[model samples]
Target: MNITEKILARASGRQRVSPDDVVFANVDKVMVHDVSGPGVIKVFDKLKKQGINVDKLWDPTKVWVAEDHFVPSADKVSAENIVKLSNFTKNYGIEKHFKYGMGQYGICHTLSHEEALVLPGEVYVGGDSHTNTTGALGSFACGLGHTDVAYVLLNGKIWFKVPQTLYFKLNGKLPDHVMAKDFILKIIGDITTEGGAYKAMQFGGSGINEMSVESRLTLCNMTTEAGAKNGIVEPDQKVVDYLSSRGATNISLIKGDDDAEYEKIYEYEGSEMEPLIAKPFSPENISIVREAPSVELNKSYIGSCTGAKYEDLVAAAKILKGRTVKIRTEILPASISIYKRAMEDGLLKIFLDAGVTVGPPTCGACCGAHMGVLAKDEICISTTNRNFPGRMGHVDSQTYLSSPLVAAASAVTGKITDPRDLK
Candidate 1:
């Protein structure tokens, strides 16, 4: 078994096991953001009113709550919701509570690692589908629906069907224009939207060693899009270096035995992949923008939990150092910490000089509510997940998902174009 399998096996109280075995596993941590926790709280209340012991749900110390989607209160309704969420946190006494405007809050997944709440080799669950982001630290993490989260919170354990393991071995060296995001888009293109359902994916290859930890995180963060239960890469020195920089050192390091069994294996040479994007309505609907026809964009965004890392910011700044963003484009950092680091490194000044709107480190545009929303017939090139029609606030609006460099180049060009083709 690999690290993920080993961790899951231990948590399931089994010495060794194969896939497809249903197991009752204790959840190590549970996370909820303001956007989803409110609904989960409502369900918990209903369960309590029906004479169910809500306290019997998960332990309070194991829950992490953050105000991310509507931080600083975007509007009256949102403000009221924050108050309600605050009340819930107080009532539960959850130690991992991150309040709004604290400058310590960002998207839940990013902030969880920042606050040192995620520990490697543990099974964690969150109310958001992107909860799989935690797996970057070598943990078995997945997203659950409100009802599922509520049940876990009540019982501290949930029944899970063991997932098959798929090994993706990457070969060759990646091109400068191609990145982990591009590689993932390529994988999704091959597998389609629901390709890896109920399967845990293990990524390792010659090319993986060349990718930075932040870049690897970007790749693993989107494993959920592949319909994967979880995604993992072997914890190498890069992993140790990254955690050490973040003041984290204690992590369970496990690797698959050389003779460990795997259900499926695929090999790929990522050297030739160009910058790719997933069109609206389907993550599998992918195309290399350079070869695709031009599409006018109403806005372009260059930040998200996936795209707001230091290297991501550096890439965008390098591309936009002396250029100006189109009037409709915007960019935001992942969190205040990231913003501070960028400013200290002079990257934020470059972005400001380029005329890009640098909002707070909150999830500004990703939520489609408080930030750069779209109008009718508009199309946005964004780095966020899910580009369904109306995702950015207009039902008729369309969103194109791409990397920060692609989004930055598109914002400057006022159209969807590849960064390599620019200037």
Candidate 2:
């Protein structure tokens, strides 16, 4: 069995086991966000009225509540929702409560790993679909609906059918203009939207070693788009170093056996993957752009839980170091801490000097209805998830999802150029 299998086995109370087995496992962590928490809270209230005891039911220390998304709320309804979420946190005594401007808050996925809220070999669940992002840290993390999250909060356990493992045995290197984002977008395109449903995608291969930690995180973060529980790459030195640097003192390393059995294996020569972009409505609808002439973007956004990372910052900085953005553009750090670190490293200066507006480390433009909202007939090239119709605010707005490098390059040229060409 591979690392995911091994971790699942241990969590399932088995010394060794295979895939698709239903099991009752303990949850090591639970998370909620303002966008999803109110829904979960309503369910919890109903369940409690039906005889579930909140204080006696679950571990308070294991649950986290973060207020992001419509932070400082763009409207009265959203502001009321945030207030309700805050009251629930205060009443329940949940140990981790993150307000919007605190150094600890960001997107649920980004803040989880940043604060070491998710740990290796643990079963973690969050309210948002992208909770699988925590799987990058060697945890068996997955997202759940509000009803399911409420049940877990009341029971500290949930049922899960083991998922078949899809092994991506990556090979080769990414093309000069292409980066990990393109690699993932191409994978999604090849597999289609529902390709990996009820599967555990275990990524490995020599090519993974060539990617930066942030790039690997981006790859795993979007696994939910394929309907996968989570995507994982076995813990390596990079994982250990990253955890250690984040003050994780007792991290456990999980790995697969040399002869581990996999449902399927895939080999990707990433070096052959061209700069790709996923057009709106479907992640698999991707194409290679050898030049930037195909797009006339009205806005370029370069941050999200998936796109806001240190390596992503460096990549965007490299492209915008001495240039100016033609269209309105915004760069958001994943967390306030990440923003401070960027400032310390002078990456923020590069972006500011380049005339790009840098927003706070929050889910600003990704939600679309808030900051950086689009105008009618506008197009945006963003580094976020799900490019559905009206996803970037205006119903008439079109979106092309790509890597931060592509976003930065597009910002500079006033069009979508391959980053390699700019070099």
The reply for model 1, stretches above 4 Å from the true place, is: none
**What's each prediction's TM-score?**
0.95, 0.96
Q: lDDT by residue for model 1 over 166-203, one digit each (tens)?
A: 88788977788777788888888888768888888778
List the RMSD of every prediction in angstroms: 1.7, 1.7
Per-residue lDDT of candidate 2, residues 1-423 (tens digit):
787778777876888777878877778889999878999878877877988766543888899988778875878998999889888888888768888755577778888877877777888999988888878787888999999998888888888888888888678667666778888887888887798898988777888877666777888888887788788888777877887888888888888889888888878886678887888766777878664347678888998888878778888998998888888889998887788889999999999988889987667768785878777789999888778888878888888888999899989887877887784
- Tell me model 1's lDDT, rounded to 2 decimals: 0.80
lDDT of each: 0.80, 0.82
Look at candidate 2 and tell me the lDDT of residue 39.
92
Candidate 2 structure lDDT: 0.82
Error of 2 at 217 (Å): 0.8
